[model samples]
Target: MTNNDPKTQYNGIILLTSYLQRVFVAETIYQRVKKGHLGIRYSEAKALLDETYTILPVVEKTKQLSVAQKAQLQLITEKTLALMKGYFKQMPLSFNDKLALVGSSLYGEQMMNNGVIRLGKLFNVEVNKDFHMRTQFYEDRTKMVDFLVNSIHHNEQPDVNLVKPIETWVVDILRQKDYVLADMNKISEMIGF
Candidate 1:
């Protein structure tokens, strides 16, 4: 019963998900789904999306959905948000706060993009997304980092205290020997979403 891969994947997925939930206030399920950063399974996505809506109180506001569909959404959102927020509370950072910080850093354009970039590199392959290519990850990372470094160089910002550390942290974690690579199903289980 060698479940290391699954376990690691699950852990990574949880880490990644926690990162996103902390970074941004997913206004809608579509926002979460379109991320493509997790490479999560549909079931996992469905579960997590459902969970997020609980605290947000916005997931239930869809305009053209059936009552049954809406009800299901409410349940999932509440349950998932509860579990994730609770499970990862002991970290130096709260999931939502970290997510908010990341969201704020990118000025809303590339939310969680830094983490995705690092994950893509650690996986040694192109992430599963149509918007950004494998090479784009490197280019984007370098451009973003270079921009930050140069900002400090010019004293334009005087310091790169915003996202550089998060980018570094992501890269370091992905490189850890015990780090897990996640798939969707396991991710769903970890969050209980």
Candidate 2:
């Protein structure tokens, strides 16, 4: 069957899971900024949050997704977006200002994961822990890309010297998973959590 066939909702779920993981990592970075531990600027954090909002719709389109899209959106809207709006209202962004934003972002992540789990249950597909681990590997690659982009934007040479090995490792892991999924003849086995 083709990749876009209905049975491949399993693959779609994996794609959605990966997207949520990126959002989760972005939230973590935002948390570090709020805690005075990182230098991520307010505008930068806002842009990341906005990007996440945009991606949420795409993630909500999974075929087996039974959770109300509105409910999922509401969770993030009430938590993450509200905090961002409140922070922007304040005169100066302070540590305390960031606390709400950080909390909201974290809560949003949990809500998203719960929604994914619910979707998996609806499809009788287990969301594997390996898939979760793969998300971290994907996040590592994302960080590498962000580092390269930032370096280039600052008129500095993008460092490729240390990235090759990591890239190879990530690609290998993904390929291994793809092979595992391809070999599975049953959806239950493919999604075995």
Candidate 3:
């Protein structure tokens, strides 16, 4: 969808943020391996995607992730986002530069598969081929992280039960904000600068 469309725009941001979150999770695993928490190499993370995919419900498939999955997902997403935030803090980079840097790694594939590029399209961000190659690092990155951290926070609380599919949370948030039209301007405002 075009970036001017509010529905598409907001959803795009959500998707992009979500993909970034997943990439963040994979990056965490990579760090873990670097720190000796896990012995696997960065190249092997893609295999874990199936495991994460398994945790998702059958009927809803990708969009209708359960509350537990959402929580687990959010944890990894938040942690990864924080890590990226910190990384950016240590060495300043614009969004494009950051995308290029991390996108060059193995994990970028997972971000792409999980809709990173698609989300970027929503925002009119142009990520290149080298950025695309990094998904391999992120394939299982989302799931492996959720599985590891889920045990600690799975039962703590529940996500808001929005009637629609989980993918539509951005739309839901927009709707909640009274941006009924939800076009590109509204979405851009909702996401802020």
lDDT of 1 by residue, 95-188 (tens): 3233333332233234235444544555455756743554465455445544554443354642446465645554444353133222223444
How many residue pairs clash in all the candidates, one count each?
Answer: 14, 0, 15
Q: Residue 39, candidate 3: how far off, in angstroms?
A: 9.9
Cα-lDDT of candidate 1: 0.39
Candidate 3 weakest ten by summed lDDT: 158-167
lDDT per model vs. reference: 0.39, 0.42, 0.37
Instruction: Extract clashing residue pairs from model 2.
Output: none
Q: TM-score: which is higher, 1 or 3? A: 3
TM-scores for every predicted model? 0.25, 0.31, 0.29
TM-score of 1: 0.25
True-vs-predicted CA distance for residue 120, candidate 1, Å: 30
Residue 151 accuracy (lDDT) in model 3: 30
Q: How does residue 16 of candidate 3 score in lDDT?
A: 32
Candidate 1's error at 74, in angstroms?
A: 0.8
Question: Which is the winner by lDDT between candidate 1 and candidate 2?
Answer: 2
Q: What is candidate 2's lDDT per residue for 58-104, written digit by digit as tens? A: 54455432345334433433343233332322334332233323333
